[model samples]
Target: MSETPTHTRVREQMNLSNAVYEAIDTPTASGEHAHKVILRDCLGTLAVALENSYKFGCASDATHSRMLGHFAQNGLTTNNITYAPYPEYRAYARNIRRTKPKLYSAPDAALAEVFAAYGDIARATWDTQGNPEPDSRHAVHVTALAAPYALREYPDLDASLVSSYSLVHDILEWHAGDTPTLNLSTQGHVEKETKEAEALELFCTTFSPEYPKLVTLVTDYEELVNDEAKYVKTFDKLDPGFTHFGNKGKAIKELGIDSPETFWREHHNTYVRMSRYALDFPRILEDRDTRAQMIEELAWPSAQ
Candidate 1:
């Protein structure tokens, strides 16, 4: 089937990102070089992020062929002229799928993290050292920044579909990870009060009112995800997942849930709901006349 105009647009973006990545030069090591490289790297994978993220009407198989074709064309066999793979199809298609968010949301989480890291880089209080070092923060940002468009696009996002706030929620607040004042990932143990609910609360507090539906959805999601965080905290004494956290399956077991499959049923259902809501934002959040006033009313105090 001929690619839809929407998919074509995605393709154009993909090509553009590839061009930017290939053409962008990393200047002599310096903060300025680092910033340019950072933005360049972000544009580099935005193609795939857009591919997986942009849904037309409702989540469906409409983009599956194009997704596969995109990967096939970008793979090693394509012998394309681009120096680096624009959309590493293999990476995107690691798991065949009927929809984008059905199987995994990590890429979404990962992409969100990329953006969050952008905020981090922006918010980072530089050390006494003269220039910012392209350290782990830059590495994590770049790593997540590079992604190919994914397996079958999520079913067409329709009115019935609800977008997910997970990525947006997660990207905003972090756990014992990188922060503006500290490198939690490397040396901070400020795990007190930092949990999924804490994360959701921060996002909810930050973005709600301006986005009431967002507040409602996450307010509900907090009830579900909060337990996972509690379990993670309980098991903090043991380094199970090497995530400094325990697995959800184990969390369920400890909680006496029916089974892993049952837990995932809830997980994926919520995932689908969240995905739909997120997908619909383009249509929903189109006008800022209301949002502007709403944001002004509830905008973070420090934001102004």
Candidate 2:
């Protein structure tokens, strides 16, 4: 079989990379306290996205073949080019299907399967009768789908970045436990508090020297919280009367915190810096301009 054309390979790799980053950047839940239902929804969304990427690859290959045919007709290449490597592309497509087999089996089947698994995990975790660990099968499926995309995009990325990203996915799955219960309480104070605390812990521990800029950005955020008299008010000014501290007002209300300051102190890392970090993954991977904008946003307060 002939190898895939260089252009096809490049496009496949680009799409895969974009998809992987999107998966990472998209939020999920963790632990016994997460909402299994929403977690299932998120997984379903990811599975569909992966499938779409496969279809996109197929279409891209067809387009490229037609273009190549035109080139040959015009005598661009004397050799008659045959596009036979379409099957090779299936390796990546197969992994996506394999990861979410039940979902891909039929229309809406995968979503139902994901929901069932999510329900099982959520019930088990919330009941407190047994360990409510995330569904291993679902976790495996997510990682398998994610790995190929990651490898294709940042082929040269340090193995550790890949590992770290996988771990991030795991954390999101675990957090899914909290999603179901998020809106149950009308006040939403407890949920917001819990998320803020969780986000803070995640932010501080996840940063490393390999991504020094990320670390620096987080550090600056910490400084803002620590010297809130100066920075908290400044952030508030950014959205006047909006209260930009401690998971912001909305997250604070969702997590159920009395004051943004309290939320900031307890979960400053995740709520402020880490949340932003997670959201930044796609921008950093897909668009240089977005990355620059992010860095500026993260560093703005500190620079002042």
Candidate 3:
């Protein structure tokens, strides 16, 4: 049978969406060309695509609109996506794989290498997306480290399983780089998920022999078929919010989110996504909101 109207519209949307990624994958030009200029081009492509997709009445029209709202309210000039230094991490992984024999003989050295690789992968700042400072900025390893501490509240869950899921949940980012929850179009999200899966396969084939359990842990976390995965997932969502509130909305201010309207408009999408966790971890959800309230009411001087 011929394609349905829905399929045709979605195909068109995908073409537009793919263009956004194509613009990103394009190399920066030589000589005095600012890299930020490339991001402008990418967003411009994304804007046209989203506008057309919304007009076609795609299922994600609201999501598309909110994404644009996020950029608009937060400041159109903002650079949200950051990438890790290319080939550097790839080289490091290769080096680790080469020395796997020696590392295998010395368990401490092997573990250290794993932690070191993870330590180099940075988390996103409150304002932007991607992994900019893999060496210095917010490290994702902190989320793994904090998992056990957060486990105290959920006393009945399997601590060992939770810990395992946390440690490996973001391991693929060592190669894939961190993709923020809010920064991408639906197609952009799909491309990121594909890239991350490819990275995970690389890890399993190259490094899993040395770190055998890694494949299981990463896969289980992705599948999220157990309480352990769900528990770890809750922490993953909360970690950034924890950092945001702990820093007293410092980054939010840097993004010029001085008003409640701007702050909520930018954050409303994330808050709605986080609300689901209330089913499994009510306290975690409550903590997120309580802290958010403080930021909205007290952190913004103009709001106060």
lDDT of 1 by residue, 198-231 (tens): 7666656754544344345446544434432222
What is the clash count for each candidate, in the order shown? 23, 31, 1
Alpha-carbon local distance difference test for all models: 0.31, 0.32, 0.45
Model 1 TM-score? Answer: 0.27
TM-score of each: 0.27, 0.25, 0.53
**Runs of candidate 2 exceeding 4 Å displacement:** 1-120, 123-134, 164-176, 180-275, 278-280, 283-304
Better of 1 and 2 by TM-score: 1
lDDT for model 1 comes to 0.31
Give candidate 3 misplaced runs (Cα > 4 Å): 1-104, 107-115, 126-151, 182-184, 245-247, 253-258, 271-278
Worst 10 residues of 3 by lDDT: 77-86
lDDT of 3 by residue, 115-230 (tens): 45554565555412332334212322232233333334565665445544544566677677777664345686788889888877886786565544445556777877887677
| Candidate 1: residue 205 Cα off by (Å) | 2.0
Candidate 2 lDDT, 1-304, residue by residue in tens:
1233444543443343333222322333443222343334433433333344434233222222332233333333212121122333234333333332223422155334534544454311111122322443223223323333334433343222232222123232233343422223534557645764565455445534223333333344434332211222122111111112212233334344444344335333323433433332332223322322332333243442
Using lDDT as the measure, the top candidate is 3
